[model samples]
Target chain A: MPGFAANKVENILDEGIEKGGAKLDNKQIEDVIKSVLDTETGERLKIYVDTCVHCGLCSDACHHFLSMGRDPKYSPAGKVKRTLGEIFRKKGKVSPEFIKSASIIASTECNVCRRCSMYCPFGIDVAYMMKVVRRICHKLGVTALYIQDTAHSHSVTMNQMWVKEDEWVDTLQWQEEEAQAEFPKLRIPLEKEGAEIMYSVIAPEPKFQAQLIYQAAIIMNTAGIDWTMPATPGWDNSDMAMYTGDFEIMGRLKRSHFDTAARLKVKKIVMGECGHAFRSVYDVGNRWLGWKRPPVPIIHALEFYYDLLKAGKIKIREKYKKSVTLHDPCNVIRGGGLADKSRYVVNALCDNFIEMHPNREHNYCCNAGGGVINCGPPFKNKRMVSNKVKADQLIATGAEVLLSPCHNCYSGLEDIIGHYKINMEIKFISDIIYEVMEKPA
Target chain B: MHDLYNFVRGPLAWTAFFIFIAGSLYRIIKMFVMIKKKESFVFTFWSWKYSLRSIMHWLIPFGTVNMRMHPFMTIVTFIFHICLIIVPFFLFSHNVLWDESWNISCWSIPDPVADIMTIIVVLCIIFFLVRRLKEPEVRFLSTASDYFLLAIVALPFLTGFIAYHQWSSYQFWLILHILTGEIMLMAIPFTRLSHMLFAPFTRGYAGSEFGGVCHSRDW
Candidate 1:
């Protein structure tokens, strides 16, 4: 239990406390905790609490524990103890300082990756417990400021980055024009009713990584897939609100995204290489809206690539000759079960595919998902340090390239590679496939 | 003293058995009742199959993903839980007691084997105690109740071992052994020991959710 000294950087929790400290009195904080514990959660909460033996077996499963010099406080069980256990112990009459610490623990410290859940002897969802802490924190308006701002963007513009409607359409048009240079007949269809797929992506794709959309356009056109991009709001599938525990905005965002697909009369939704977005639409948001499953069938980009490769729709001209390793995004592999298919897609496009130790569902997280990276620059040093385990995992592969199929993992890995000087190039599956695939005549 | 022995061996045993069964049933039933219902928007496929598969998957010793992570602990825990359940139910003395009380009899392990198993259980308990104390993560998560439960589980075997060896007051050790066994039985449904009953449910639910929807091959 030695102190884990923070590097020289502004801590988001301290800032959140300074700003949101007086917003909630002791009575209000207690009331919020009581209401959430009593009403929001049911047998799941009670059973998990009663069943945990505190064996600490899940400690190794967490990246924070391993990367931060095996600090016990960073372990999944310790995080739960610091937040939920304290709440139950004090009967929710915790001080403002406790709430501030709890918010930091729930929001920034843990990624809600659920890899620890996979490792729990009793399958206790520590991520779910962390989200419960986040729910309480959200009620008190004590969420990390940057992630809260992203959630606000979801509220106002139906996207995390607040790309206006015209800007979104313009990005698609620009990508379409770029793709047409490769295949003159290629077009990025917009709001085309009855299309086979409604392609959706996070707002960052347009704001920053527009080439991904350009790549998608090329792939879709080359494969002759009937796909459309929504011209209206709801094209962005990412949900910061879900991570922030703002279920109201999360629900609206999900509903609008699904409703957009329905309005377009598309058969299914094909989301980009984003993990949290897939989880939000298929699991958390759908469940919140009383749907046991998503109303529309949504396939992640990994699955989409696998299907295309398997169906002979997108043929590989020559496998990319690089010693590449795959970073399994927790949402898609552990959360969505696309491990085998992801490998299939990777092997099909890459010549020398090396396996990372503890690959697939057992793989370490990219330290980005669950809004940890979205907590923004103030917390970058913390994120990088906590991701040291991942850097070592990637380094051990001795692969020249790291192929991550999720946007958050891509960004997170980029940061890790640069910080650790790991001499690796990171690319998404689409980036590789687009380079190596046989273009339609 | 004769009355106390009979009460501890007879009425107290039956009462503990009743509480154990009833309390366990109540906990499991209440868990199911408390789960909120939701309608599936898409057709759910092979949910029951996945749940059953998950339950069977984790039931085998060292079969879980977590168990594989720590090999030494897995081996020790596998031996410990097997001995924990088997030595109690299949011990020769327990089978004899059952036959005398209700004309019921079952297979029993030999005396020497049962004794060996009890020793292994005691060793495992000590190992676990050391682990809780030494491992910083485990030490942080360990509560008074966690330590108390470990002691509660170890008491019966320890007292039984002493009574069988006739190393101390035989009658007193015997009485303590039976009393501690009854206490463990009553505590099972209320403490973390309830994992004996709920592990299957939690593991199964997790398996079903992952396999059915996520199509994850977590097991």
Candidate 2:
């Protein structure tokens, strides 16, 4: 009852916000805010702030505003006006309480999904603005606890989940041993220099979902692709620091990940089904490190699966029978542009494929990403309430299974489906692909 | 009274245009310089194909999902913009002034049609003002500057309408129209009206990212 009651109420008391709030004096907050606004932001921020007429045309594009009974503050323009707009108006002379709410608004309220950007006539990216507020929050040391811990992990160990070096190698060997049951000769290659493909994944795969690694190994072996995963800290391609506003840690994590891949001398890094990690490595991280593109070319799993299926490297033995729908992750579909390819793989693996309305780039965010879920348990119910639009989108599909290719989307959709009691089971695309693909005999 | 009217419609009008054109160029070049200093990579990703594609979509009424969804706003916005630009440039009286001033006149709409367009613009401004006040989502984002900007935009039209229709104090309305028009023109570069200048560039950058980099259509 208490657990249910907590879900009914919003998370008003968070240790990270409260503790960070306690230490932040008005002057400190003001100085940090001023420093970020002047130096850290670029032409993009300057243009966006000047161009947004506050026409409120983007009101419908945001999932949070729509789901929260059309709350005015949830509107993307309103959120910016209250937080960053206030900071700008006052010339960074805002209070600690204001910083606390701004942190909550920036970190938990927005997914920075870039969905709203598409709707603006000028294509004003409020997500970029929210991230600016987040950068200010991170500087103020008021980032939500769980996500901050993840950033701290990235700084300390170069991975999000803090998987130890031995634990990582152990997990790979363990998955390799588990997967060898199907093919006696199959191996999850670890650190083979000059391997054509370096298969990279988020830390969560090794930390909690080892079976996905097992599944990936089976696919790689079946396709006869020569791939190697690093045994060191760089194996994790996810960077929570990118979302937590700690760009310094994000730059470090990205550099290490690329270095590990380059050290292997792989032709390309085949990133696993993790959207945010792919974003960090391919888009945001590279830009921060002064590269227009990733140092090592990285392709997301959605596109990787498409290539495998299209090339006849992986053949299907039998298609999945259950009627399934696809949840397009924002980072991949919108950010990475793997929309058609994802459908290509899904249709290849499943007999019955149903398309969710507003599919592809227009898909609503899972509400778990952009460090929203990384803000952790305290904000679970808040997200559940905010993602009612997503729940409705899923429920309308009336599918038996939801196939999400991105790991963040999978977990986020799981929470939505369970919270709404939508009578749909969620599975990764790899799960369905592994089930139906022809294996080596 | 005659001298004030001549001064407002002549020298003040030139001053207003001077500030509008020079200030806009200054703002644009300043932004480019800032980009060069901080984030020059903006130059690396600009795609003319993507930029044109995005601008075209937004230009066409109901071409985007948001525009299509809010049919009333879309129609009002498109009509408002068309009338705002068309009437001022091609009105018969304005063209007559150009002919008198410089022996140059291209085309002019009949005064009756111009009158209808002017009234339509006034109604559209009212609709926007009412929406700003009535819609809570919009109201929350609205600032004093927003309302002030709206009034400044409407002033030239209102005064022009009165002067054209030969309402009370025609000389006063004529002088006021030029003064208000000058104020709005000069405000364009300094205030949110600069969006008219920045929209193309911002939309181009976003379109470049979405199309060239993300391989997706922005609109």
TM-score of chain A, model 2?
0.97
lDDT of 1 by residue, A116-210 (tens): 87788777889989999999999998877788889989999999898999999998899888888878998999989999999999999999999
| Model 2: pairs clashing at backbone N, Cα or C within 3 Å | none
- Tens digits of per-residue lDDT, candidate 2, B23-114, equal 99999998899998887888988899998998999999888888889999999999999999999999988898899999997699998999
Candidate 2 per-residue lDDT over residues A1-441, each given as its tens digit: 566644443556788999998998988988898789788777678778888888898888889998988888898888898888998889899999999999999998899999998998899989999999999999999989989899889888888888889998999999988888878999998899999999999989989998899999999998999899998878889989999899999999999999999899999999889999989988999999999989899989989999999999999999999999999999998998898899889988999999998889999889998989899988888989888999999999999999888888888889999999899999998998888888878
Instruction: State the C-alpha lDDT per candidate.
Output: 0.89, 0.90
Q: Where does candidate 1 stray beyond 4 Å?
A: A1-14, B36-46
- TM-score per candidate, in order? 0.96, 0.98
Best by lDDT: 2
Error of 1 at A289 (Å): 1.6
Clashes of each: 0, 0
Indicate the TM-score of model 1. Answer: 0.96
**Which residue pairs collide, candidate 1?**
none
